[model samples]
Target: MLDPKLMDEPARIAALDRYDVLDTPREPGFDRITNLVRSILGVPISAISLLDRDRQWFKSLNGLDASETPRDIAFCDYTIRQRAPMIVTDAHADARFCDNPYVIGDPNIRSYAGIPLETPDGYNIGSLCAIDIVPRQFDPGQIAILQNLAALVVEQLELRRIAERDHLTGALTRRAFLGEMNRAIALFERHQRPASLLLFDIDHFKQINDNHGHPAGDQVIRGIARLCTGLQRPSDSLGRLGGEEFGILLPETGQEDAARAAQRFCETIAATEIPGTPPLRVTVSFGVAELRSDWPTCESWLAVADMALYEAKRSGRNRVAIARHDASHAT
Candidate 1:
């Protein structure tokens, strides 16, 4: 059992957020590890489970039909609270799990073995677990194998974190941003959840570079990224789409709210002086587009947003333009 006094919940969640793996589509890299775990351990179920705020989301699940379970009812929840591997030889005989729903009902988990997927910074973000339907004891050799596999899972997560972020602004790279947009699209398709995109770029950015030099432009970009990152919610994603251009994906947000956010961003950036040799003030134009049921792909959605951005630039910059649902133009 984990001691309540030993846990720093907020810091742990922040560490997990740095990975940016939540709500992402399953990848072959993770799926392969889960598959290997099931095969090597001879378990009916093996999963790479990440503990979100209220749920234990499966990054990869082998032999499981469900994608997630309530955190309170998850066996992996306990695994993440301690450094050592958590093993239950018989769930029915254990006081902690005898009344668990998964133990008594579906899956009938009789045995379990899990290793904590600890980040390099020492936060236990989740677990890699091997589950069995029949009571069994895992030998020392088997535990060692599971531990090694869990390390591989953490390594993959670290690699993804490095690959997805921009080197200068620490924002999501263009490719990773598009990937996140696709994931949001999938979520909206499945659950009809409202989401919106905001595309913006620094107004007269080339003039700033030419007048003040490229170093000044780089500082301005970093400043804008920091400002937007600070303003966004935990669920929102900020990305560096290209030179002087950035995109923000606001999950569960509508066009109206997103436009308001973009307006705020525009006003804030225009008012603040970015730190440099002489300091620089810059304005930005914004395009806001909500996810539409008719849009079939991420590219279509992005195109609409891009059109709206062009409208903002045409309408005198430092303003927000909302894309129409018809995909024709912005208002």
Candidate 2:
């Protein structure tokens, strides 16, 4: 039976989601820690595991063949539910894991030690675990080392979260946005998946800053970001591409769908009254560009979208423009 705490909780799930590390490619920063842990602990397998809604995903698996396992059967699940490290000397003697598939079948986990990867706000998002195929007791000094290593994992997560987001609007920073775009481009190149980019900026943003104080301008920026986030799908990524300009990367979407989304954002901004002392109103222009197979780089893809944005501003602000195959624009 699963622990009661393992049941889905909105706040816990949200806390895990904030790190945005699930399903991401392995990085050396995490891989190094897992490798070091496995070597130092003399364990065959070491993994940086994140407990998601239904599965335990491994950010870095040193010796495991599988990347994830069901949450109900995950040892890391039990580890994350407590503050202290969980050390099991023998899985066969433990009723909780005696019948577990991993214990009964391949990899036959006999000994396990895990430390909860607790966030700064006191949430245990996941665990750093070391697994041995043979039964062995983990000494107090070994547990302490594992606990210290887990802290480093948490620090890495915090650093990544800080580096990826814009300070004011809470959107992806320009560098991070482009990095995601590059990843999307690689995915498209590998699997021929559809993706699109929507670049937009506030109309007469300078005038707003000129009329109202800088604080009001900041509020407007935050408001626009919130609106865009609310309108976007979970797969879509919104990024603050400097100043009043923002970009949204829509995976598994085409040019038409991206243009429609941009149109919705454009209309919404024009209609909604931003909260302020005077309750300011604003409008925005948008440019949509679909990822093409022939594009050489992410910058080329961005250049097309930027051209479309220039066309929108040139024709008239507060409208959506799409980039075509021939470098022509359609509004």
Candidate 3:
């Protein structure tokens, strides 16, 4: 049995969450790593593993049939605990794993070598390992190669974070958000499926910073970003357009649906309480525009949405307004 203290659940889990890699679509970088491992080491199976709360999930697998299994039953779980690489040249002879279910059951591992995949901040999120059905010694040269490969995998994950995520808030950054909007536009053009854009900004944000301080204003921004993000479906993309402003791209959504979603965001933001903050609440204004062929490009569509947002601000804050494009094309 593994000692609970060996795994710092909170730090490790937080580190894992920061990458945002769990259950995401498989990428070429990881697949390439596992394939190289299998080829270079002459191993039957190789995988990049990530530890979630209870499961050891395979981010990449070559010659492995399973996607995930119990963390207690995973070799990578034990490997992640070690600062140095873990090698079990003969599983059946090792006291730590001799009677382990995996060794005695399916997969029937005989030898294994794992290099811990450490985050830049030094959290061991998981491991990159090669498995063999027959016992074999893992030389220092081979172990070094595994270490380098593990670093490459972590590098790829970090690159994804820089490209897709905003540092202050967990929302997508402006450029990345626009890329998502463009992709949605391409899909709409191909299939003529309904889609919409929602642009919004916090009301009286300067006042919050003046009265409560910039830190409180930052907390408020993060709170609202999470609020809008949590309300959307997986297909939707929410982004921090700029300070105190955010945009959402809703795929397969029409004008009415977009309006309702914007309303929910407005109401939710108004009613929610910011934890560990001073006695202050915030409100937001929203503008929605459904996809239209006449709008053509993503920028053009966003311009229309921005116009609607201007209208919302012109009338009053804390309300949802629809764009002329959506109103004209309402179906």
Q: Give the TM-score of candidate 1.
A: 0.84
Which wins on TM-score, candidate 1 or candidate 2? 1
Model number with the top lDDT: 1
Write one digit per residue (lDDT tens) for candidate 1, span 1-331: 6655229888888898888788888899999999998999899899999998999999999997988899999998899889999999999999999999999999899999999998898898999999999999999999999999999999999999899999999999998998899889988989998899999999999999899899999999999999999888988999999999999999999988999999999998999998988698999999999999766478888899999999999999989999878874331
The collision pairs in model 1 are none
Clashing pairs in 3: none
Q: Model 1, which residues run further than 4 Å from truth?
A: 1-11, 179-183, 186-192, 204-213, 230-235, 271-273, 277-281, 328-331
lDDT tens readout by residue for model 2, 105-143: 988999999999988877788999999999999999999
Scored against the true structure, residue 26 in model 2 reaches a CA lDDT of: 77
Give Cα distance to truth, residue 325, candidate 1, Å.
1.3
- TM-score of candidate 2 versus the correct structure, residues matched by position: 0.75
Question: Would you list the C-alpha lDDT of every candidate in the order shown?
Answer: 0.92, 0.89, 0.87
Q: lDDT tens string, model 3, 1-331?
A: 6545346779889889877666655678889999999999999999999999999999898997877889888898889887789999999999988998889987889999999998887788999999999999999999999999999999988997888888889799887787677767767877777889999999999999998899999989888877777788987888998899899988889999899999998998899987647845789999998888878777788888888988899998899999985543432
Who is ahead in lDDT, 1 or 2? 1
Cα error, candidate 2, residue 104 (Å): 4.3
